[model samples]
Target: MSGLAILLLAAGASSRMAGRDKLSEEVDGQPLLSLMCRRAALTGLPVYVTVPSDAHPRTGLTGTATTVPVPDAAEGMAASIRRGIAALPANTEGVMIVPADMPDLETQDLMHVAAHFHGGDGPILRATSENGQAGHPVLFPKRSFDDLCELSGDQGARALLKRDKVQYIALPARHAITDLDTPEAWAAWRAANG
Candidate 1:
């Protein structure tokens, strides 16, 4: 089966970054969002990014990851997911959702999630860390379209996973759950995993 389309969530307010936008931050000389877009592109599936309207174009995501503006981004992360789901192509089979701050995620890990999604195998599928911890870049089959569209505020897909039909796929990489939310976590992630 073809891989799932990816939604790169980059529209967060980044209030914890202390006035810095984590997406625009440099990781190995490339903007974090740019690196994430490149990684998502490796699956050969079209990628979409939810970002603020005033976000810098230098992030290299302007044309590649179709930029869906989230006017209420300050409200929370779920708004980004809502906008991303709204902007998905009509033919999108399923969506593999990943935050742009998780720049260290490799293309193979994404493919691993997509590979687990199949017809009648359930709509909700997620990647688990090596020690059995659930993480992001979840694969949501078309069955949850309505729920995804209804998301708002800071509450993400957490509600959908409670529907009992969700399945799990363990991807074994710690980077699967690693997101740069604070300076301390960012430094620890870089030092431990990068």
Candidate 2:
């Protein structure tokens, strides 16, 4: 895990949550952002969380995980990813990017992806549903960092995953596809799994 870093993306404005800040919302008595950061820490890998400057004070993320502030978070996910990537250590071999809204994303799923990342020229490992739908916590090798840095707008690294040269490991986990972006989605998740 020394070569791999976990970048927790928490910089979004949560526009679909009906004025609510999804990261501050509680799941099992813990804030969702804090829970995700803790889970990322469990792998013993370096964890960096990207939060909007305004949200940094209330994120409740400390300790081994570093908080990266994206002043232009409103620009979209690319801004957060750029900030996180820019903060990475020069020796980092890869990065696992996980969204803070994925409430059901388990530590085991992250560990599984991290464990599968071989150093040097390795494939992008993405968590997928049982039916092969790609999901969050995508692992990108150092070779792809440049491409990731060039991203703009709301686009993520999904475009990089489609490259013919890029190999892929599809980890099967139902929770990987579950994200609580809206109030209804959050309520539904809480109702089903709380």
Candidate 3:
């Protein structure tokens, strides 16, 4: 119990990928979901991944990270968020919600967010690009867990982020905001980075 937990959101249908499973897509020779899970685990924080019932067998995630099946995942992103939040340990003073589709989000980036988390009294910590664009792996204090658990529909945590008392950490890496949702975006990312 490091006082913080990471909820890896992987339950989405990836509807825009044209039938391709983005989580199964490999980056640097490892599946995207597995890579994110492994990186979050390396930070020594409890990592819980929310995936659809059918996604567990293919995720290839083992060891430190726990896989939580979001049976109602098809309902929307809210379902996954609620499930993941409920699965967090009781001692979790804060949680970093990381989306599995962010290919450029590296292990160090996860560590950066974890390292910056203070405690329940601190403001929400969000990673931002050099240009001031807010990004994923947003750390929400325990104070906000109630609001998070109430999230509904496909909006995720955007509503929470808009509230006051949020702080941002600028990550030098440009990949903090890069999310591969479609085939073209995925191919473009590979061509640019690989």
Candidate 3 lDDT tens digits, 1-194? 36988889988898999998888899879888888888888888888988887446644653467888889988888899899889888888999998889987877888887788879878999999879899887999999989989989998889888974888988776767998999999989989986
Clashes of 2: 0
lDDT of 1 by residue, 1-194 (tens): 46358888887777898777777777878778888888888888888888777554533554576778888888788888888888887777788889888865888888878888874336688877888788877888877877888987787878878864767777656767878888787777778856
In angstroms, give how far residue 5 of model 2 lies from its true place.
0.5
What's the CA error at residue 156 for candidate 1, in Å? 0.3
Candidate 3: C-alpha RMSD after superposition = 1.6
Provide the TM-score for each candidate, comma-separated: 0.90, 0.93, 0.94
- Go through the candidates in order and give the C-alpha RMSD of each one to the true structure: 2.1, 1.7, 1.6
Winner by lDDT between candidate 3 and candidate 2? 3
lDDT of each: 0.78, 0.83, 0.84
> Cα lDDT of model 1 overall?
0.78
Best by TM-score: 3
TM-score attained by model 2: 0.93
- The predicted structure with the larger TM-score, 2 or 3, is 3
Between candidates 1 and 3, the TM-score winner: 3
Worst 10 residues of 3 by lDDT: 54-63
